[model samples]
Target: MRKKYLFIGLFIFAILFTFGCTSGNNPKDSFQKYVDAWEKQDYKTMYTFLSPSSKKSISEKDFIAKYTNIYNGIEVNKISVAPDYPKSFKKDSDGNTSIPFKVTMSTVAGNIKFNDTAYFSNNTKDSSNPWSLNWNIKMIYPDLNTDDKIRIDKTFGKRGEIKDANGSYLAQNSYIESVGIVPEKLGADAENSKKQIADILKIDKGVIDKALSASYVLPDMFIQIDNLSMDDTDRLSSLAKIPGVMLKKTPARVYPLKEKAALLTGYVQPISADELKKLSSQGYSKDDSIGKSGLEKIYEKQLKATDGAEIYITDKEGKKLKTIVKKTEQNGKDINLTIDSNIQSALYDQYKVDSGTAVAMNPKTGAVLALVSAPGYDPNDFVLGMSKDKWNSLQNDPNKPLLNRFQATFAPGSSFKPITAAIGLKTGKLDPNADKNISGLKWQKDSSWGNYYVTRDAAYNSPANLLNALVYSDNIYFAKTALDIGKDNFINETKKFGIGKTLPFEYGLDASKISPDNSIKDDIGLADSGYGQGQVLMNPVQLVSIYTSFVNNGNIIAPYLNAAKGTPGKILESNVFSQDISNTILNDLTQVVSNPAGTGYGAYMPNLPLAGKTGTAEIKKSQTDTTGTENGWFIATNTNNPKLLVLEMYENVKNKGGSHYVVPNVKSIFEQFCK
Candidate 1:
């Protein structure tokens, strides 16, 4: 009987111990779990922790959706949730627990931080958890309440302006009219009216039909067909009498320089769908404008507008209650270029009729003043909206009006002689005063060259010396000079002038090539390359930069576009040639222009002291091919001030006096700037 009594006592003690443990539940621990789920953006887990009364107020799906939509709309990220609570659990007089918490996150508008209290019910009845959150809209946002809505408001900033060195507009914000048609107002002759519209707008009739046939279009709704610049829309005044034609003025990007600066400034258009998807996180929308080409595209970060945002609480009446986040809109920074508008216009006016490209730069400062690619299409057409027919015409034009020739490379022709001469002098292979015993207008290194031979202008059959060779543009002299320098030495020396390397400039320029794969195959190939023929191609800007070494005491100046980044006299390759060699070459090039017998004599002008070289690069399948074309090249600058260095190239100058065809044209531009 005593043993049974002892067993009963021990069992009762064990039961009491289990009951004590179950009653030791802390509300702070439950609150911590809810805060953790909030930080992870786990709305479902947070919903499961809500009190029965809170759950009855909002459905689980609606709760999760509300958090998601609001967070995404405001671009919320980097979420943090911290709760301020005591070490021990305590209950208020009403049998509830309240814990203060802080919420922080990054948004497009800016950072958001707020503090609020989380209330939990102390009653554990009919629930597995000892604590349940008494959730409400205030728990999501401190300023939010029932029947209140969270809203995001956007304000767009103005796009920046592109200006010349004189602060003249190259590209700027302006106005245009959106031309459209309303089908309901069109008379019985709707097809005829569309034909007339197509003719006026230079568009296809099918384009109008497709736009009107859209599923979203209504008979009275305005169906936009094309846009026209405000300054150029006078031609459309006759369309006002038409039944359905309408013009709505809208903001647009305008190019004042038109075709003259088209390739330099490029143009802007509405952002594409793919671009929007990629840039959504950057606060970019489908309605935003994006740069398409040229400087506009390259400097997009500095020229694009920054949108401002405001996240606020609104009532059912659509009245704003409180602002949770605010960001000020910032306009894009204006870009000032080193381009001189006067020089840019002068070069374009001179080269507009030819199939060629011209570049004028301040050789000493490395400031690229003018870049003109002739047969240019107006950039304003792109901004005003181009029609299918107009676009096709530009694409089909034999002259290739759309090509940015300045960005392309071509054979330097005789223009590359200076480089070869410098290399020859640097390698100590050629004596400037010593005359080479080369004869005839055409010569080759023995019969190993077979039928292939280097030909020179018949006008220059004088004794072959360094000065006379450069002045006469004697191909055989330079070819013989290259043979003396050898292949390995020539290529290694050429690389010092930035060949086979990327140019450090804002504009994209093709790297100047030395030879096929940077290697000369044989003596014939080396001879041809020495005169800038065999795979010796260079962009106009790079050619101008290399020429700068002659005036910069044998140092190549790095060419620059944006005025802000241009450091005057910034050396690209230091000491490419010794001071004595540079001076000698400069004097020889000067004589080529001033002397009547010189090949570059066409460019000679009195009192201007111009120095330059002329080149004619032949394009043919073989050396003996009679049906071949020639590209004319001219590099000229004032030897005194050494300020403006110009390079001009014209295609298909065969039987047109070769490189001399562009020499006079280059001289006229210098007259406008200097004389």
Candidate 2:
């Protein structure tokens, strides 16, 4: 019995030993473990699967370095390994085993798919040898060989063009010479060469030195100077002869409208280091040009193109061996605006001497036809690299050319009388036909309010109703009407018109303020607001929107630059006025331009019936003290079409007349386009 028990024990021990050997020598298990480590980027665990001979040839640090270097050039979004790719192990006659794998890597450049084999071996002659992988770089990329590496080549996509409503180019890419200096070629005369280049380019010599001093710039690399106009062939030829100077034609953003549309179209500049880091996930490089302001900045993503990429294997000397992947770059989408270039040019031409803004829109649809801000600068100056002196001149100019006057706020003056009239009619505080019988060229405010007095032009002393009051721009009549409506009703009516609220526009707008806190506390304040005087500030765009309600059956549609036939404009305030009130207001505005006694009579066009209001707002030192400086305004609409509304404002008019100064220009614009 003892002998039988010993035999059974020995047999059980042998079976257990056989099972342990089979598990240790399993090549499939070793390859799978190595693949799992690789997928997780656990290089330390991956190194554990390396064969003793392989580890002897390369250290763990070198193994990790090989993969990390390839990863730095590409953004890996995802890595997918096929579960059934390595179906079963295949044994070679030489006792080597291999497992096939299919890996798909999703990257910013696109997807990359490749098939590779992981080799494993077990030395049958050595009793203690376990299954081990003979890993190499080829296992990661099949095309990789000794002294060969994977390289990614990027091709930037074409930027889109900005076109006007008539399909005219506003901003587009044009070929310009990229001037630079090859530092290594400068030799011992680098300083002299830089001075000569700067003199020819009209740039500071320090700019060249700064470029050369960059840590990343190598001696052979070209340090950029500035983009020169293609028409500057004479300068290019002369500069090319100088040592270290080089010129290459490259596509650059160009503003065809230049000074005419500079404030509206804006410009682009090279991305900064901070922008590069923020936009890295979007594939933007430091060399890319991005919109800095205006519409260009607003539609950046739509105007920005997708870059293409080429992946290939390259030798140690950087010669391509084979192309693995190629992708075509997609151009950006073109942006169509509602601006009419011809009308825009006309508007700019008319306001050449004035420092102000003007906007014309389709009252029914709220499509802005033209927007002009005077004292404008050439956007091309920025695109072609503006000089510091020129930039400083623009910045220091008293007129403020860079300021977007369209979005700026100003006192609406008598142009706001219509809104006051509408509020009086809407609140049932004043009758359009009832005789207010207020008689004054100038009327003093009540002693309780202040010693201040409301004054009108000497020609407007007649008894007034709403129509004659608007026609004569009688400040006394309107102020009394506002007082009758009371302060609360006036505040509510103005708020209903979207005052004190920001307009939803792509270019951004300042909220029209009635007061600092949008409230009027005193009778004098109410009286001033009635004449569009007391702390009432409005923007041209928002003012146009308010005027649009009169022609649109009392629905105030927010004005938009990109409104089209199918895209409806946003309705900021609905039913702001009854149709009867709108018609009454329209009729009153018409008489203001048609009647010889009206203040807007200067804007009369014999061929066309025009409806508008004239305003002469005095700039005040305080709410009580009026300055001699005045701002002239004319807000007009065509009665024949009823679809157009134009607002013009000229600042600091001094003694150049009242709203009468801008009336002829408005008439000229109306006759030219409104007809």
| Top candidate (TM-score) | 1
Each model's total of backbone clashes: 0, 0
Give the clashing pairs for model 2: none
Q: Where does model 2 exceed 4 Å of error?
A: 1-108, 111-143, 181-197, 206-223, 231-246, 315-327, 386-395, 459-461, 563-572, 623-628
lDDT of 1 by residue, 296-351 (tens): 89988899998788999999998999999899898998999999999998888876
lDDT of 2: 0.83
Error of 1 at 287 (Å): 2.7
Worst 10 residues of 2 by lDDT: 81-90
Q: How accurate is candidate 1 locally (lDDT)?
A: 0.87
Q: What tens digits encode model 2's per-residue C-alpha lDDT throughout 1-675?
A: 999999999999999897755556557666667778777767788888788888888898988877767755665545666534344455688677776778887555777899877677885554544678887768768888868988988888988878888899888888789998888899688788889888988878988888889999998888888888787789999898998888888888888777788888888888787887688668675457888987788888988877888888999999999987777788887888888888788888887768888898888777888888897998777778888898899999998999999978999999999999999999999898888777656786666655578887764455578888998888988999999999999999999999999987777888898998999988888989998998999988999999988887788987777633324556779999899999999999999999999888988888788899999888968645555589999999998777678888999876888789889988888888876
* Model 1 lDDT-worst window of ten: 18-27
Over 4 Å off in model 1, which ranges? 1-152, 181-196, 209-223, 386-398, 459-461
